[model samples]
Target chain A: MSVKIEVGAGGIPHNRILIYGLVGSLVLIYLTYLNTYFQTEYFAFFGGLAAVAALIWGTDTIKHLCSYGLGTGVPSAGMIALGSGVIAALFGATTGIFAPIVTIVIAAIIGAVAGIMANHVVRMDIPVMIVSLIELAIVGAMTVLGLAAMACGTFEFLGMITGTVSFLGFTVQTYETSVIGGSIIAVIFMLGAIAIQHSFNACLGPGEQQDRTLMLAAECGFLSMIPVAIISFAFIGTYAALVALVISIVGWFYTYRKYIVLSKRDAYAWLDAKPILEPKGGA
Target chain B: MEEIVFGIGITALAGALATVAGAAEDTESDIGSQGDPNSQVQLAPQMGYIHRIFNKAVAGEPPAYGLWVALGAGLAWAFMAMQINPILAIVLGSALAVFVQGVYATTAYLGRTASLAKFGQPVYIDILKSMTTVTMAHAFVAIFTTVAMCHLIISALGHPFPLPLLGLVWGIALGAAGSATGNPFYGKERQYQEQKFGAGVPISASGNIVRYAEAGQRNSLDNGFFSAKLGGPASGICFGLIVFFELWRTVVFEELNIWGPIVVGVVVILIFAIIDRYIEVWARKNFGPYTAPEEASS
Candidate 1:
């Protein structure tokens, strides 16, 4: 049932995309900090775009893992990915010291442990399960952290800590920041989850093709930006929201059109008229 | 603070009294209508008290029962609003609602799984594995919508609404919407029976029984599509009302009380429920008995 393409068995080689996505997002994160300290919201907006790029990578990983037909199903992989991702992102963002380093190190450890548990303890039995889980976790975390940087206008540790409530009442003064900044986690979590999962789930069927599936992934990634854009309006301003919304619209249309073309190419038949139906038991 | 406490206590007491009265009336009607000898036994108090409470909260009729649960949830949130950070309050409140909904859905799923096991069918492990993810997705969407609405309120009013109270309102609205829209993917038995369950069970041995077992299954895609359609609008309205009231409170009525938004929410839910019922009927009449053209042709 798998379609083989010249590039690889799938339309795009997973490794190539994964490499591009990983390198691309890390660069964007660094740029986001530079812009926050130097330039304007426009540059930070570019950093937000990095999340979409990471989503494509995440979706590819999902497609790869899910293609094996895991007993737990596709969405479970998405959940596991996001679960580890959110924890990592939150941990990284909130750490007052060496935030980026801490986030990656912790996320990798958690992802590795989760992968081991899913494979050995739960006996999911898929050979690639371990690596897939680890990669998904890293990508998921990166996506969350990246988008959050865009939303909050920086990847710096201080601003991110603005709204956090300390359990020991040490940070009660930060309550205002908590109200404004805390909700960003929730937004990113949902958007990341949808972008990672929806692509494969929507496109899976007999005639499934890799390019089309990836296209759908792109569409979902853009769709996820709608909420981010709305939240941007609240946090940044109308200009930021407009920028995000415009990019999302353009991306969505481009991917959607490509998907339609691939879908048409893959179609075997089309029903132009409704068939007259006789009554069931014998009309 | 004392007045707030007193008001909450009074509202909760009133709601509780009304629920007890309603239950009594419902019990009488249930007995009269069922006329089964075991109807009284069915009414006998169950031992699993916590389970019973969850089942009542999560598994009742669509919007009506869901609204009732939301109302109770709102009251609970009101109590917590004064104590916790707004974000924390929302997280906790929504988490509680989602957990209840998850347990309720899982219970129904277990019953279905048990029935499949009885027939010596190979129940796919995928169903079990994906259950948590599905429930979480539904809950996550609810939380996102709620948070967005809260942000809108804060932005428009230039002040935050009572966090816990808003959370409760969103929780109930979204929770009820989640329950009402329901899972189209797994609810029907027939789809799996034909594709998965029928694989092992011999037709001769099962005879006409296999058809009976398969009767409950519906097309997963159709169910999913319908669910999204119904749920999207219901929750959208809930999100909208939050924005509307927040603006109203800011611009026109600085003193606009909590009751105003809650009351508006109830009316919107009622309208949606009525529309939902018609959609249900329409879907059953028109879109019922769907078979994939490819599958049919094959």
Candidate 2:
């Protein structure tokens, strides 16, 4: 006999929740655009919020896809998401002001093809594989863009790749920057990949619940932002970088507390112990 | 024209190296009994079937390989910046990465087994002593090939991205290919050989894996022998084609315009999508679904 179990069986419909995440993240990611008009790095932390929103959506997508007997696909999906997304993001970040939107389009195309390959060639046979992959791919792109913005305070290709000074039409000198030259994008790649994937993997089980998983996802998103924010000190002023750090820590703390409470509610028993093992009746 | 030829040559070399890396990756994972199927190994102890399996899943293959290849490429990049010979730098970097992989394998196995001690799962020292070096040997091969491929892309192809970033991307792809194309053989065929072929694992059989060997007791080393025959080669082909096609499009069409490669990529994807649909339909028609218990009895 075979049985099927829904991840968030009785809660709000996942589609509705997905909409909330999609709209919320898209809006938050645009906050980086404010930097253009204001010409400041104060709004950089909004990129971190965008990352958190995308991870929430990614967690739900992973849950939906893995429900179809894809016990191994969870991590594979995340990795493929970032792998394709990285390529798309590199192309998109080159475009000014429209980087986020362009990234979504390219990532969608890449992810759709991958999903088709998995379903038909790899024969995964999950019904939602195509759509879920599209969503994860978009989420992966947003996470990378968000963290890269947080790290460099801008996603401009020139800003990320080098530190150069220009006078009207003449180039003065060029120096190495941390984002690509120092290989910090590599850090962002792993950070976003692990943060998006680990939340669901850690919370998955028969008794898994939606609220706890989402909260942990949010916490992980913020936790990942901390490193990027710290790295931003190399690109932006200390004061601006500190603002991003404070926001990340605060967000992380709030979500972490909520996750712990939800875990307690769902767990059959809770034991906060030192060693967590003791002599039993027989022993 | 000369540039095109050089690019094509580099693409073929990258594909070949990717093939080697992909094959070695699956072999290493099979030897360690990692991935989704490792769940069965974890369950065996609780189900009163303790055997000698190396449970070395510190992380998923993609992320784990990304770290290993990135670390190696990063070290190689550093060494190259210091005017060291590129080939020697890659070799030294891969050696250091192998050390890291070895340490992680040792710790993961020891930590997991110790936690399962309450289940009467004794630590098999002989298996641990023998298998760690074996896994490291395969890890070195995988890491070396992957880093060399990254170097080829950067130096020969003049890719804009640095070595570490390229390493991270290709490493993840190699692991993804192995996970998608190769793992089924290890998880389904080898792990559950007693089950009827093509009948997917039933819900009732979760965690009840085969524990006894043909001689005494099964181990991860035994699983490797079976997976190497099919899984490794399949993964190699899968990753090789991915790298080959990706580079081929860029090399052949980039001169026309930036959108040239994009168009070619779309066409390639459409081609694969069509082929995949054919394969899926063929398999379904030929194999059919698993026979139900009630149907079998009737």
Candidate 3:
């Protein structure tokens, strides 16, 4: 019956950002991010914000990640994984080579671990994002303190201060390399994680596609990073990499469209089966 | 902590009552009692109770499992594998929450007229259908809340709610409350069906499995044909109420972190469990077959 089907509000438009505004905000965040004191204080704050966002959203989302019937939350697990992994890798690298590696690894581990909790928080969209914003405020407070410590340098508070120093220890060149290199590795590990997912179906089935997807993604990253690792290649300019990144993202977008859209279960089912015996023109 | 456990305890107790009511009923009228092929349990009455309990269970499932301090929240975590929101990517995600009904009813298409309509293939296939269930940010928050809550609970270990422990404890407590006591909606659909139709076990009629499709239109009621037909909405409603109450209290008064009130979740759940039991006893004994289905409606 028509009564069974219901339309929920879902078509919130993605406002096309003005190029000027988009670039301006990026400038602001980057400037803020790179400031020694700001970096010290705000990285954790931003990290906190990301944490909160992930937590609230994770509640309902985990349900989908786990089983069916219980509604899944929004933002989706794949998005969560990318955002968290990137954010953690971004922040943890601030301290040291070890810090970035450790942090990214930890974040990835947490991302996977949090996958278990995705089903918990259920409202899905705004609530989860709001939580992340609140966490940002909390982390901001922590960042403020860290900056003051960085300025003083004498104020040692356990390994955190030293860790912060180690974070700053990387030369700008190494910073770029590690951030770029380390992120690539983090991506690799994330791909491996499907084998460890909690979803019942994922567990029950062969999971071969997921495995293949992971491999393809890893190869993509590996290829992309080859240019970055070359000492001479370092001079290629950020604008170039950014262009490549955009192209890659667009390419993947189309690929996803074809893979996910054109090849839907329903569509394939439609094409695969023998056509029903048609009734004669006025039977 | 207490609230979540109490909530689940109550829902399970509700589930138990649904089961007990059936077990207590006279077998002749109920299908289980008839034990014959021609006999079918009267659909309407049992559906009513099942509807009521299931609604409570769905909304309440989260809070009940609060004690476990499980679940991680956030955006990044969701996309750790596939970057896009799998739901939008898949489109099938829209089916979440309503999926049980969909799956439950989908099986009915397999009814006796055409047994091998290739139903078995789809049965397993349906589970893979994705829902826009979670996202990167959601996973982040969940992880943060869950870990933070665990840290808070384990760190203090002794006292109730501490600021550090708020997300973990209260989140769990509230989640469990919603899951267990808020309504029978969490996973109590089966229990609801069992309690109502359970009295007359179908000869071969699948219990709630087939009921998903058969669940409508015996009597016209205010809500709609399925209002009497569909009952799980109550679970959503109860969940709404619990969410309303919790958010109202916290958002308005800022008790989001204060722990003493957390014990209420636990205590209240326990109380609810005891009451649900009492309600069942009263319904079966005093109400004179109030909870049972018509033929089974002793």
Worst 10 residues of 3 chain B by lDDT: B51-60
Off by over 4 Å in 2: A1-180, A184-283, B293-298
Best by DockQ: 2
Encode model 1's per-residue lDDT on B53-171: one tens digit a residue.
Answer: 00111122222222223322332232232344545644544454454334333322222222222122222223323433453444434443344344334443334544333443444
Better of 1 and 2 by DockQ: 2
Summing lDDT over every window of 10 consecutive residues in candidate 2 chain A, give the lowest-scoring window. A274-283
Task: Please report, in order, the local distance difference test score of every candidate based on alpha carbons.
Answer: 0.48, 0.76, 0.27
Task: Write the residue-wise lDDT of candidate 2 on B110-162 in tens digits.
Answer: 44454455555555656667888988888899999999999999889988888
Q: Which stretches of model 1 miss by more than 4 angstroms?
A: A1-8, A94-102, A163-174, A177-181, A270-283, B1-186, B189-298
Winner by DockQ between candidate 3 and candidate 2: 2
Tell me the RMSD of model 1 versus the true structure. Answer: 16.6
lDDT of 2 by residue, A191-215 (tens): 6776677666655555567777777
Share of reference contacts found in each model: 0.00, 0.08, 0.00
Chain A TM-score of model 3 comes to 0.28
The sequence of per-residue lDDT tens digits that candidate 3 reaches over residues B1-298 is: 5655544444343333222212111110011111111112112212221111111011112321221122121111112112344223212211221222222122111111011112111111221121111111222222233333233232333223322123234434433333333222211332235445334344333323223324631111111222212232342344334443443333323344665456555665677689989989987786566243436332
DockQ, computed on Cα atoms, for candidate 3: 0.03
Candidate 3 lDDT score relative to the true structure: 0.27
Report the C-alpha lDDT of model 1 over A1-283, residue by residue, as the tens digit.
3222111154778899989888787776667666556656655565466677777888788877877754225556666787798788777867643555566677888888998998899986778788888888887887777777766566655655454334465635463443233444554555576457655644443445677667666665665554455444434545755776687668767866675555444433222222212123321
